[model samples]
Target: MTWRRALSVALALALALLLLLVVYDRPLRLMPWRKRSAQPEAAERRTNRGPALATLGRGKGDGVDLFKGEPLLGEEHIFFVETSCALDKPQHVPYDSESGLRLSPRGACAVEAAAAAHPTHRVYLVHTCDVHRRSLAKDAAPAYALAALSIPNVRLWAVPYALHFVGTPLQGWLASGALRASRWPVVHASDVLRFLLLWKYGGTYLDLDVLMLRSLGEKKNFGCAESPAAVSVGAFNFALDDPGRRVANACIAELLDYRPDLWSYNGPGAITRALKKVCDVQEVLEMTEEMCGGFRLLSTSTFYAIPWQNWNLFFTEESSEEIMMMIGKNLAVHVWNALSHNTTIYTSSEQPYAQIARRVCPNVVAAVGDTM
Candidate 1:
């Protein structure tokens, strides 16, 4: 009778302990070795929560730690620069109030397509904002940015001009407010920053409007020709330590004499001028390695498959199949957002742009829905 009473008391105490553990939300491990088994459950919870935004980094003098704790920048880095500070009020695409300071649906699709195409590369979406001041909370960030950030290899960063341009020749030009003198300050600023970014980082820099169709693969130190005589600055790659960075160095140096009145002069014109200094501009049509001192000039079809003159073809239902076939072999397709900004994209429509968005950046397409 005494032994039976003792056993009952022990059972009652165990039940109370189990109840307390449940109330406190602590798992009860009956065996100490089972603690190791719980690790998988914890890991699964983290996996379900998705990756945290990789915007955390300390700004060093003259340069930035783009991704503080992540892997270092190697050849596997792809860059997309967003110079527009009016992200919340996008001028090009339909604005959604719920998205909060995110890129337009089209812009986000460009980035997500790049990330999805090259899963191994760390795709960085760098914004030209003052990094020290602007830190976007997860809930407050727009859906496009959040959706892009959800990709495992994608990272978002806000870069300050002072930090990024410190050691370069553009430092003086920027400090003197020469950039403000431009008729199109934002466009000109984008031109200046792209040159500086490539010179300093030596990786691929893509415009927010360019959609990726394939991996760039070992191709470095190259630019796609927008025409027989002009090189498109929208998509270009240069190595950081490529023995003096001839083209990049030349472009940065030319920016000091930047002309504000002429629109394309500072953007496409700058690269065209730089290539001339390195190699014969006429040879660019041949795309020979020796033509530009080992710089490969890709054909226009590689990027600008749909010429700006026919930019509306992307939106027109009639040109959808023709445009798709044109860009089938190309590495990417430039949506020509500059000309197509006013053109509306009907999600339900069979336009090539909408179809590409659905195929490449489905997450963004789904998030924005029929509004895009």
Candidate 2:
């Protein structure tokens, strides 16, 4: 009787094991523990990888990196320049705009959106401040993990570190006898890097201060007009291997030979000057909404609805609803931090900046303990 009972138990166990193996060998997984982590695995991959090597213009002589695999250039990308202070932690905390770019709260939201916006496209936040940057606040790296989320499509490109041992396009300009570092602000470095990225890797370049309310729809090669006919360099995109890259190349060349003429000499001014020759339009105001030399020209109302001079309206405004309604057909809005840096983003009560900040970078706001 005892031997029969033990044989029965062994047979039952063998049957269960055979059934499990058969189920697993079929279509569906037999065990829940064996389920694959698709999203988390992809996010992990994104954290490790950097930008796809720009193959078109950046030949061996142009200083392209040797090891990084050239991901398809046809793949879409959204690039942002953030030369942030290393100590600026808790990225959502409100610091003086005059201090630097909105690296925390605003930047966190912008990067999150840009990465998630185009599900397939890659987003690069170029941290170009290698060493010379001054620390404005405390450690923001921990809080940044929240903003960055497990964004599989986003990459934080530390420019100097990435190109440390490799040859880069900028080395020529840096090595040139005429180049002077004295006149260049670290901010100007942003401009130089922006132009270089656009020229090398065909994609859109956005300012860290800009925010997008929607995904970057269908990608195209284009620049937004700040006013009626004046194009702003703040938001622009290009198709891979587009001829428009030449315009960016010319701008970088001018940036190499830069002088402090106009405040925006290295930025908008350089872009406008290049477009004037290519667009063949004598009056910038005369430039229409249509394509200019195979490039889409977006109007200010479609992008920069508020002028830089009127930046105060964003802060003092009483109602967030009224301001949102006024955004109209804009693809995105430029915060114009350069003018509004000193303006307070928070107030005793609900202010426009706070409302916007809460909606976009909620994680940051919560981390910083901002009153809702």
Candidate 3:
């Protein structure tokens, strides 16, 4: 009697376990397993079956893919164009945007100066920002556009800016990664910009926060400003001219393709991934910190030094004044104070006011020049 009862209980337990496993199989597949999915691969084929731009950044309808298939990193124009093209939409206009379509006078001036300074170089205003400033009303943006039109050498490109909702799939993917988990969304965006720029322009990537004290064309080699090894490359401030572009582009492409997941939240990982592809990257690093794109202040000789407070200075200061000063002297400041996003350029003297920037960088002053 006892044997029969025990056998029956064991059979029931086995059946229950089998049922549970079957129920969870599909859900487990939904998780990020090492195995590849047949779905995304198949979908990619279906969606991309027709003729497509050789790259994802450059979409159709933006005129000829003159830069198509040809590497993007070395050519500044292609970089700007491709990035602008990828981000350019007719303006979807997000709901929470506080500022509308307005460009600060200071911002306009900088664009003008950039264009005039580099007439042959194809200067562009690559704006990765959102919509809905009371200042940026429909009427206002047009005025900004008009001002931009008047600027001799500059063109403007914009993305309908919005906060990266942490709950979204992309953000979630980033947060889940081991390498990317430490960084904020802004870092992710900055890295994305790097890939975009490297893929598109490859010459030099300026963090939007940078004030552009002067033209960076003079720097011949890879310009890497100084920060810590962890934060140094600044990816934004970094510059990769003609040859480096090819290396960076191939490296970035490989990283994106091989570990698209790493691109999710890991800025440094993306950079690391790119660096791994090049054999002589160190020689390139030796050229100029300015080209490397960190906090190398623009001067007669490019030196390696932290801009002001990008990495750790902010942590020490009770007030943000020091940071503001850094923002002022440096063309861009990493405004990564927020937990979830990277720092945006201090275009205005609003809260987190870059008063020092107002004083030193005329371009910064000019962008917000109209502000009192």
Candidate 4:
């Protein structure tokens, strides 16, 4: 009787142990703060991140490929664009994004500025489509990306903006069938991607035209003022898990609710609408330190020292000592590249932008090599 009982108990224990092993095999990693997924990028992300990730709080976005937006040593600075070809569709192949993704010399200067100014921060040049490292070396815009990639803290994030990561409130709105695919043009698509990046990663966002002259300093949450009366999301900083980002994530859902003129529907107008309500201020310029986006409104002199209308002065005017002094005061300079991209100019040191870029972000000019 004793032998039979012992054998029976042993068999029962074996069965229970096997079942426990099977269950625990998958669930054991869920025990505590550790969350490393099967993907190599996830592992790399884990190794690459530092104190900033701890500061960001690894509560929700711990696993999966979708959560590629991880924190590194310092802060993440994001930049994005949609190619003219990608505007009308949901899915974007690499070719669709190549046009705008390629970096011109001026665009490269912008990248160099940010990377050099905030050497410790993680600078991410995000794009939609497949951009190869070799391919980037062949052209002007890609030279910027390649140059930026040369830095340990800088990387390129090539996620298919609207095509992938259909998890945001903005994606839900897009899928709601409010507007036909034709209505979602490149400009609108770009705007949509920018909001998603801010909501997901919660870092600073900048336009490709901006050149950082100095470190962003203590202020971590703010947007630049295009004018005394208007705020532009061109140069912006928002922390990860920020509620204001959530508000922007939600507000941009109405992107196609009513289409206006191109710029009004997708560019500054879109940001104006979202930030106004999020910051709880009627006038963007009137927003104060206590306010949301207004908390750190960098005046036009801070970013857009020369307004768009006077964009020519950047090229025509020489960098005399006095002008250089004024430019030095600003943290970054927006060269108004959008307005000037098409206009041809013999890029030389005589141009204020080229001069400043050469001084602050030499890689941009170096990337140009003998061509410059």
Give the total clashing residue pairs for model 4.
7
TM-score of each predicted structure versus truth: 0.76, 0.67, 0.44, 0.70
State the lDDT of candidate 3 residue by residue for 1-372, as single tens digits: 699999999999999999999999977755322233343332123121111111111123322111111222333441232122122242223211233333443344334444544555545445455333233422234443344434434434444222121232243333445223323333444455555444433455544333344455554324343432322334233345445554456445544432433433345544543443443344324323344343222331132223443444433334566545544534333433222123333545343434434433444355333442
Candidate 3 to truth, TM? 0.44
| Model 1: per-residue Cα lDDT over 1-372, one tens digit each | 699999999999999999887876644433222232222332112211112222332233322222322124344778877666422222333333332344677888888999999998888777654332233332344565567766777766553444556556777887887766777776877888788777866888899899998889878888988987788999999876553298888888778788979898888888888777777654456646686777878878889888888888889898789878887878988988878877888877899988888888888888777857
Tens digits of per-residue lDDT, candidate 4, 1-372, equal 699999999999999999999989866645332454445363336432211111111125421122233434334555544344343443433322232344466666676777777776667666554444333333323454455556555555554444433555556656654334435455565665666666656677788788888888666667777876666767776665455554556446545454633554665666666667777789877666667643467677888777888787777655445566767677877877668876544445566766786787677577666333
Task: Tell me the whole-model lDDT of each prediction, alpha carbons only.
Answer: 0.70, 0.57, 0.39, 0.59
**3 against 4, candidate with superior TM-score:** 4
- Which parts of model 3 are misplaced by more than 4 Å? 1-120, 127-138, 142-150, 158-190, 225-242, 257-266, 280-304, 307-372
**Candidates 1 and 2, the one with greater lDDT:** 1
Worst 10-residue lDDT window for candidate 4 reads 49-58
Better of 1 and 3 by lDDT: 1
What clash pairs does model 1 have?
none
